[model samples]
Target: MAHETFLKEIGGKSVVEQIVDNITNAIINGELKPGDKIPTENELCASMGVGRNSVREAIKILGAYGVINIKRAEGTFVTQDYDSKMLFPVLYGIILQKDSANQIVELRKIIDVGILQLVIEKLDSESLYKVEQAMKDLETKITTFNVKAKDIFEADIAFHMVLVDITQNALLEGICFYVDQITRTSRMKAIEKFLTEDATEQFLLMHKEMLRVLKEKNKNEINKVVENHYQYWEKVNS
Candidate 1:
């Protein structure tokens, strides 16, 4: 019975899935340097004692998430700058099960409001310039295109990322980085349902206001405005 159970666990798992995990761990641990060429399917299969089909499947899976790249006739190579592709699965599960857009928005707002206080006091000219540039780029995109649901959602993320960056806290910045990635797909879907002409106008106005607050170095006002602005998205979801 124990042997049967062990076989069930192993046989139920895809060889490709196992290979992807191994390679991902190696990358995270710095064993597989960026741009390193992974072994060929046959080589990996021989080395791991896994079948060639399993090795190929693993390579394909990694390629799908931008973890690795395969060149025609060249070779499969570990990505030079791969982020965590595995997190997407967890993100997908969270988004699918939570059914609460407002919960995500609320979490973002809480983080951002804290960041705003720091920015009001510490943001330098260059960081302020970066925020303005991101706003301008978003405005340009909105003006040029019909502003697809995806575009609006990305703009929203970009706008907040600028705020996160201004805080100059590496830990906070890293949190926002992955938070953006995890929420992106769901944000796109939410925007598709809730985004409208009025919503765009409101957000653009809020960006302008935020820029003004930064320029004036108004700490209390900055905190108040950021909290209120983000709360709008929560209201929308509600």
Candidate 2:
């Protein structure tokens, strides 16, 4: 452990952030686990040899990242699950910069593609069944003959959320929360601009293709389907 070297150079929020980085590393490194209570503020202050304010700030920051959760009387504890709330600020910052919005969407597509590919082999019948159910829900919503544009948008969102849950990777699953928020906002705007029954049917068809590829365990085909699916939205939004 590079303990001394890490402690020597402390500046700005760098110091507080470093504390967070170290603690997160510890958790990932298995030095900490879910249900393990973090040290009290006083103990943390003493161990880190930092002021109570700095320790408190570090705790708050980590809390936001879903690394830890605070309980009123029980102190803080490591979370069993990753929370997407931590990524909101990053997403917000990206949104404010118009140039990065498209870039983030591209990044999101890449990550989503990777996650699906990674989990393809591990996908169980139960997970596949869930996907089928979501697909059916989407099909029903689209075939309602007089489906509102919002219904299609919501069905699309539900489909992807199901994909996230199927991944079985906490970190990857967490990204869905923030990415969906951004995607939903943009999709709603686009739908409002150009609402069409054709678009809804097109999306449903693409989802069907995606399900077919997953069932075949064809990674290349899966990627192609997903790429086309996202490209549809990109063309609309662009």
Q: Which is the leading candidate under lDDT? A: 2
lDDT of 2 by residue, 150-232 (tens): 88788877888788788777777777766777777677665544354356656677889888888888897766776777765
Candidate 1 residue-wise lDDT, 105-191, digit = tens: 766777777787788888888888888998897777666556687776677778778888778677677657777776676556555
RMSD of each: 7.8, 3.7
Q: Candidate 2: worst 10 consecutive residues by lDDT?
A: 1-10
- Model 1 alpha-carbon drift over 4 Å, by segment: 1-13, 82-94, 110-209, 216-225
In angstroms, the error of model 2 at 174 is: 2.5
Estimate the TM-score of every prediction.
0.55, 0.75
Task: Tell me the lDDT of candidate 1.
Answer: 0.70
- lDDT at residue 24 of model 1 (Cα atoms): 71
- Angstrom error at residue 54, model 1: 2.1
